[model samples]
Target: MPNKRPITSEDLFKISNVGEAQISPCNGKFVFVKTTIDEDQEYRSHLHFQRFDETSSVQWTFGKVRDHSPCFSPDGKKLAFVSNRSGKSQIWVISTEGGEPQQVTQSKNGASNPVWAPCGTQLLFKTSLKLDQDESVFDQEEKKKEKKKSEPLVVNRLKYKSDGAGFHNETYQQLALINIETNEITELTSGRFSYEPSSWSPDGKSIALSANLTDDADYQIVSDLYLLNVETKELTLLTDHNGVYTNPTWSPDGKTIACFGNEREYLGATINQIYTIDIHTKKKKCITETWDVHITDAAISDMRSGHPNPGPIWSNDGKTLYFTGSENGNTSLYAIDENHEITPIFAEEGHVYGYTFDEDRKFAIIGLSDASNPGDLYKIVLGEKKKTRLTYINEAFLSEVHLSIPEPITAKASDGWEVHGWVMKPHGFEEGKKYPMILEIHGGPHAMYANSFFHELQLLAAQGYVVLYTNPRGSHGYGQKFVNACRGDYGGKDYEDLMAAVDFVLENFDYIDQDRLGVTGGSYGGFMTNWIVGHTNRFKAAVTQRSISNWTSFYGVSDIGYFFTKWEIGACFQEDPEKLWYHSPLRYVKNIETPLLILHGENDYRCPIEQAEQLYIALKHQKKDTMFVRFPESNHELSRSGPPHLRIERLNHIVNWFNEKL
Candidate 1:
């Protein structure tokens, strides 16, 4: 046999990935952002250029600073992208061919979502600011940072802190335009509200956007589409429904606008659907309302490749729309025609995370990831489903590594619901040898685990553990009622469904050692791991990462606590503390006999460290075999997007704990 090695964190860093593919308008050449970790342990994403007809790709941008979101000009002469080479992220314009990039905007807070105006000489981008604050106010704030004194944040809004971006007193992302030739920047919309620029109108005089301009904006998840006039500074509202509207792509004739949103029928757990609006008549209709799939991008598997919200990609004729949605545990690209019939475009069995097409939308540049691969770019012919692999960013690593491909497993719940999952046997497995197994759960409680590449799962399998991950009821891509089943019943059927899955795997797979079984998960998965240990203690060892142990404390401290608690559990601490305790894993901590490893991030705002703190204290007080490993300067996304070194350490911690306890 050829010499091969198990995949490691350092090997994963060697696997450079690509995303945000943009096809140049001038020549139909492709330019995308390639992301990788350098020796210094910082993420470096730079633009790279390639011709679809060519066999190789070449680097376009260099250095350690991150560069991404490549958008070609209308004429395709230059490309606009957000880069932080000069300290803060700003829009930079570079030639289609190799050339020095020109800094177009100098926004203090930074600029993103760069879209070239139809006029080509101007562009629209997004920037955030303090409420009722102007550019000069932020300029003064930047000068204050130069003095090197950390200022105290005074927060007043109910939704003052976000998971990734913390402690925003009063900030709103607004749209603006800049004249490239003259370096003159024009603010498009201003107010206490934030504006997300979706698409500029064909005439370049108006732009489509979404914003919630309400006093209870934090409570209200819905936003209305507003058409802003570039010259008059006038705003016209379109589709004022009780749903969040975003990413409005204008039709070629400018008669309609396609947007991705949902009526939020299930509150926080609602699967987003595609909707279209008549710009002239102000009439709106949900196109994918009955489709029973999440219209937004749910294809999340890699921390290296950032998840860009998939769109209602409009064909040049506007008669058809293409988008990425989850179905049958896989997130792939699909299309909807004028007859209201939906069809799969590049709908194979994989995670189609991001895709970009030309003005005509006849062909597309796609980014996909599978069980054995990280991610790569491909070219797809819209009508024929012809795919041409464009770049193999992880070829070298995958070629040299021995990765186990997962086998699909299905089990019917006691309530007759079908649960879809996969099982990955350990590498170098020998026949008739019993191996220790692990039950893996996904986060989001709303997110699905699909036929995509997962680094952690593969790493666990490499360490001689059979990894099993499934998409339970609360996960997206499994239809409306099924995805909504876990809501108001967190530890009830969701718990049963997981146990049934494990029972099914153990019964069918003889090679799995039932006595040496282990369980681990993060986020909602973390909560389930905690729940599993506290409820039954069937697993010999368990590792819970960034988890929620107490719901009462979770309802107040978590970023999404205010709304998520009432939405998921159907009750709150203020309403009924008993209901919270009934589902909280901490409530049954006295029964936990399984050795539990609690992994938490100190800076995790969504599931605060206090959740882990309470669980650890309770377990220790009860003399339970429990250990809490706190990762400082890390957030909830530590597994996927945190510092590279810390991520390796986390993996090492999990492996060490499992190896020691199991």
Candidate 2:
């Protein structure tokens, strides 16, 4: 093979990657979803399998349609997974030895997360059905009638539209079981509320699930755990409080259940911790309470697919537990014993996004991505913490292209808080020459900018821009105190932390051109970019994506706004209108002079397009150099999981804007 050319947005089309691994019951084989873009320019995912003793992997399914969520039966002979080949997503089955897959269900609303029964006689899956309907009567033809009708959307629910899922329908997700032999489907749970089936009990007589059954479910973000009897469909509450909870994994003995959740003491800013509940006494204990670590992995990077929580994987002993978490810009596997002593099992300079353990639970197949690798499977010794590379998904492409190595840097903020960041040098760089720099900020304000592979940053570096990203005070990977710092303070010290990073880079890195500096960010990072340009003209250009410009409107329009505003910004419209304006970037828009490029998603309900609209309108009225590019039909996740061509266009917009201005 010859050396490949520098990576372009189009190069993404040729790349094929794998994720969402599932171990077979025999512990010797595993299956994962290998995703790639076809000629239609749409993402096509197919299942691929590899045995522990095998040297290479074999494709299990062939299709341009998506085939994901692989689940191996108890005996390891049959594999059940969700696929959209027959139309809407539904459960499909195939023999592990190699055979044609059989479509099991034809639910009108579609099915997902198929989990096999303990005896392997049936499979339990989730599907969205009409509120009052009890049978699987909504078939394919009925769906056509519903889709053909030109009816106005009627809404009365407190929460209506979602970003990607779109406007609220009367239907809600419920758990259902399908007998494998008879192909008989039975609705296990039903109500106006939605239910997410997590894990089945050892005996398979009951299942653990989570749902928010509160009167004002939309206003309340917290969910309670429940145990649903497989036979009688009886619901038993496992937890009750004003806190968010999910990912329930049962113990081997079925006496205790391990789960992940947060008390919401500080609301959305609260760190997610691990908990355990006794099935008999119903007593729940916060296992990782005293620990300062955020049990949930919050690392941010572009080279990833879906961030599903691979919840607490219990060892065969059931006394030991393992899970993945983010800390100090790296996400790795961690272990927690019966005594609640947490230890980093596989901490390294990369991101461990997903993993699946063998039947013995001695080893795991890990999905790893870092600065050098896009993503690949690695076999890891759980107890020894040793890693062996299994697959080279992007090795060939990477060997040809020059990927910039981001040198990690650290500095003290204006408030004396330590700020962690990295500076990616230009590709094929000469130490003596100067280069333009771009300060990249990540969203989630609570999300950690980690040592992970990012397509956008690499593209910019390939274009000769020194890209710098940092984990400011509000970002995760740090302790609870640090992550909660920016809450209620919004643009205060958090802004200082980011600026300190830029200052450290300019002062320490001699090759970076000071006058040619630029800044760009998305979501919360976008809010900071808008605020940064408003406050200082230090940067020559700025790009804000899916950003928030007005706190007043963000409080009501966003999906999590009603309470998130009260938690993050400290007030609502009526409680503190003046304070909301005080922190909003729109209020300080008059002071901006930097050439700004506003990138936004029209369907973005998280920040809303109004944020970009108002900012661009204000700048245009003042005759400032500003342009707003709206990506139609895209939500907040336009850069990550949006249309492939549109994602390329977004990258082009960012590169061309900086190339032109900086």
RMSD of each: 1.7, 1.7
Clashes of each: 0, 0
Measured against the true structure, the TM-scores of the candidates, in listed sequence, are 0.97, 0.97
In order, candidate lDDTs are 0.85, 0.87
Candidate number of the best lDDT: 2
Alpha-carbon shift of residue 456 in model 1 (angstroms)? 0.6
The TM-score of predicted model 2 comes to 0.97
In candidate 2, which residue ranges exceed 4 Å CA deviation? 1-4, 132-149
Candidate 1 lDDT over 340-447, as tens digits, reads: 899888888888888888766778888888897788898888778578898878777777898889999998899888899999989788889999999998888888
* Candidate 1: Cα lDDT at 102: 87
